[model samples]
Target: MKFIEEVVVEEFLPTFRSMLAGELRERGLTQSEVAELLGISQSAVSKYAHGDVDINDAVADDERVRETVERLADGLETGDMSRVQALVEAEILIRKLERGDLLANLHEAAFPPLSDHEGPLDIHDPEGDLRTTERVLSSVRRGVRTLENTSGFAALIPAVGSNLVEALPDADGIDDVAAIPGRILDIKGQATVPGDPEFGVSEHVASVLLAARAAGSDARAALNVRYDEDVVAKLDAAGYETVEFDAEADVESAIAEALESNPQPDVLYQTGGFGIEPVVYLLGADAGVVVGTVRDLV
Candidate 1:
């Protein structure tokens, strides 16, 4: 079974790199400068300069590829895009092309049997639902890492433990959210992540985020931490808009009521109910921002 990465390395990389090299040269960059910008050796740049590398005409002629190359060249020349950012853009484009697009066509041309498959392959679709889920998972991972590394963050874990969660941009159900496989806990005074982040792994925090979204909040990420007067004070001190919901009632309804006035609160807290642990949720545009706010609490 051949992997798609092999095709990327053998076919896509050379062609794209050659095209980028040519674009940079046309933008008045020297060979050495192009090599540095593209992270290739000078001799490799020389080869690309001389047309010694074969580029797939399909990829080379793609408008998307051409636009990306031109944009990257302009950005690199004008110092607007870092090499890392350029690389990320290229990688994103490559993933898009790999999903039954240009690269998939090339792959089918190389292996005739793949074209006989039942339906379109979406393994690398950048705009696919699966990719949206993956982006949420990645956001959760970043937030979890931040919490794990923050000094004394374990102290924020409540009896039910803590969880970092993020939802797809158009999330409608719990399955569209990604969260820790198990609750994050305080183990020996250290924050401990139970396992890798995954979709459909979190129920409580995911529900809270979904409820907030249903209440007209545009937040896509949420983190639950222990609730206390001190934490509330800290959130207030940080200039975060705080809203309170009733824990005894339906969470969604209570949240909906609280949001009727504030609408976009940075913190949502609930007072204790029968056998229900009181918790505070931090919400933001993404997990990174949520985690950054959490770090400020420490």
Candidate 2:
């Protein structure tokens, strides 16, 4: 069985080393100088520089890789970054990219069976950005699927359209929240998902979720739907704490103020303003729970 680490050592290293060596050479460093800096033999440097070693184009052409190489070359040449520091930086990037990013994709490609492997691999950091991001994306997918399957879900879509969103555990901004790229729309009584979910896409729903979190709510997922008195009343009857926020003011501050007294509201609504359409937002533990709540309610 070929381990994923083998792919990294066999492909990533040669490509990165070659690129770095070439960068150093372009900056007037001799092969010996490059070898000394890289802690490799001069012959190895020549081999890499001469294209004798097969290079991974994906590794070479990665935007992060190019930027890192340029920065490392400048630092190494200027003695700003120590050899150990350079190695550590590269190692960190490698580790990050290996966790559900480019390197992980490469590993799965090289080992097809691994593509079907369940859960985070031992090679991936459990809390790494790639894994966590994928988890959020997956959660959003489940929620969206729930909506797509639920009967009458389309009628619930507000005039402005609907979005299902979930945030990372420690989401700091919109980029940390994953949601449908385009808002879910009702077309001919059907809920149409324009594209797959991605991070930093849902501004209105994501903003409300983040605002609630800032106001002491633990809700990490939120879904928006058309608002009505019956809807709000049913949520309250079902023991969901509901809060109404000003639709005109800033969304973040408005939700914050509304939840100041009722900190852990399960439902938040805003009546139609001069131009704002009335909507109800459901908050829950994750995308699945939030969408499930909507399915049960509607």
Candidate 3:
């Protein structure tokens, strides 16, 4: 199935943009400031912040593009490494738009082509109908309370999702869940195969971080690869940096270190780290923490 539903950008991008504008405003940043950060024009920044322009929809019409976005979104929301892999593939395809050979070159990439489903992908949750802020808050409160009442450490995982429309049901008032703020640490656990046209994990990391950032979390990407320096440099170019841990470091230990390293507590996002294995560990051992998943593809 096509992992990304068609209406994802249409329904979620506005909220994402608004959240970004709010961040800029809260930080006392001007359009010029944003323009400088993204290397765009001041006018473009104004238009972007004011909801007059969107970078996502400009390329949203392409089915493959949309699906890739969805994959990343899902991977981030749910912490599913497979979904992230899907996103990486999508990104490689999108870059084809800039290739001199374009279609001819893409035809040789030998990646799985996107499905033909061209509509809102069904993401069913019967309880998502009532989307009041209070309802959301209450759910979050319950989850937080559960965490607090638990033993040693508690981790909260929100539902995996692309749009708040679908995510709200799972994370209504997640913003106010815990009294202590969380820190987001995104991890890219696996290494990219050289010359591989598909880039999935990184895209998954980006999408989840984007959503977490929108939800008022301070998010950063992390990776520990043989080419750590190069990876860090690339992420830095994109306004992000990956934290490197020792190759022998245990995932849980690394996660703990990452959490302790961040001065302010907001949200800790560990992507690419040992994938579901760490998740299983976190669930079994860290009952005090609440864990959630947000994803498009399983």
State each model's C-alpha RMSD to the native: 11.9, 8.9, 25.9
Which should have the higher TM-score, number 2 or number 3? 2
Candidate ordering by lDDT (highest first): 2, 1, 3
1 or 2, which is superior by TM-score?
Answer: 2
Q: Give me the runs in candidate 3 sitting further than 4 Å from their true place.
A: 1-228, 263-298
| Runs of candidate 1 exceeding 4 Å displacement | 1-125
TM-scores for every candidate against the unseen true structure: 0.63, 0.66, 0.19
How many clashes in each structure?
Answer: 0, 0, 34
Alpha-carbon lDDT of model 2: 0.89
lDDT of each prediction vs. the true structure?
A: 0.87, 0.89, 0.33
Best by lDDT: 2
lDDT of 1 at 291: 90
Report the C-alpha lDDT of model 1 over 53-146, residue by residue, as the tens digit.
9887888889999999999889999999999999999999988888878887777777775654434666565786545655677788878888
Instruction: Quote the positional error of residue 73 for candidate 3 in Å.
Output: 52
lDDT of 3: 0.33
Question: What tens digits encode model 3's per-residue C-alpha lDDT throughout 241-284?
Answer: 23332223553455445445442232232333432211111110
lDDT of 2 at 128: 59
Q: Clash number for model 3?
A: 34
Query: Model 2, residue 288: what's the lDDT?
Result: 88
